[model samples]
Target: MIPVFVGMMYGATLGGNATLIGSAANIVAAGVCANEGRPVTFARFLRYGLPITLCQLAVTAAYVMVLSKFLR
Candidate 1:
């Protein structure tokens, strides 16, 4: 259950980075975690989120480039 919750939070926060309004879910998730006694500070989230987001974006871009090459 803990692993599931962590994974959900990770995905939610990652998706939340897509837009300003979407970030509400990230705040809400952090609040929930705090209430559950596992507080996730903004800095902590940013520390992990930023790198993960960058990596994901990089991978996605690479995939598109490869796909375009194949299609062309």
Candidate 2:
């Protein structure tokens, strides 16, 4: 039960990286930053975000694999 919750929570949290506008908070942040005269272009965001997000997702996947091995 706890594992299920943890997995779901982590997945949902990670989904924030699924796209530039994947989450509401990200949109709000971008809007705020833009209004502050520091606009974050989608390309700029992706340049950094894509690699980090992919790496994090990979790590999470590996973790889940190991966790499943143990949990089983």
Candidate 3:
């Protein structure tokens, strides 16, 4: 239960970085970029964000599973 809950929260938080609007930090970065006249558009973010988010989530999920195995 604990590992699952932690994994869910961990995955969610990290997954939030997968988009310009997925997180506060991302939004802030987008705002900064916009101020610099280089706004992070949805398509622009998707190009990089999707892969990174998917990779991170995969890794995190694997880690959680391994940890649960050892812990249990």
Candidate 4:
């Protein structure tokens, strides 16, 4: 259950990052940023997003490992 929850969260974040306008509000926000000459690209987002996502996944794995050991 915990893994599923974590996976869902990861998936949502990934899906959001997949498109510049995935979220309703992001479409407008991205447009504004682009108009201001500061458009965000997928490469730029991935540079930071990948590490952040990996860290979150690692923490989740650690938590699951610790909990399982303690509960046993």
Q: TM-score, each model?
A: 0.59, 0.76, 0.89, 0.54
lDDT of 4 by residue, 3-70 (tens): 55655666676456445555665567767889999997757756765676667667766776676566
RMSD of each: 10.6, 2.6, 1.1, 3.6
With a 3 Å backbone cut-off (N, CA, C), the pairs that clash in candidate 3 are none
User: Which candidate gets the maximum lDDT versus the true structure?
Assistant: 3
Please name the candidate that would achieve the greatest TM-score relative to the true structure: 3
Q: Which 10-residue window of candidate 4 scores lowest in summed lDDT?
A: 13-22
Query: Comparing 3 and 4 by TM-score, which wins?
Result: 3
Q: Model 1 Cα displacement at 21 (Å)? A: 7.8
Q: Arrange candidates by TM-score, descending.
A: 3, 2, 1, 4
* Candidate 2 colliding pairs, count: 0
Candidate 4, residue 28: the lDDT equals 77
Model 1 misplaced regions, further than 4 Å: 1-15, 18-22
Question: Model 2 over residues 1-72: C-alpha lDDT tens digits?
Answer: 655766777777886775678788778888999999999888887787778877887788778777877876
lDDT of 3 at 63: 91
Residue-level lDDT for 11 in candidate 3: 82
Sort by lDDT, best first: what order? 3, 2, 1, 4
Give a tens-digit lDDT track for model 3, residues 1-72: 979898989888988888778889888888899999987898899899999889988998999999998888
Give Cα-based local distance difference scores for all models.
0.66, 0.79, 0.88, 0.65
What TM-score does structure 4 among the candidates reach? Answer: 0.54
Which parts of model 2 have CA positions greater than 4 angstroms off?
Answer: 1-12
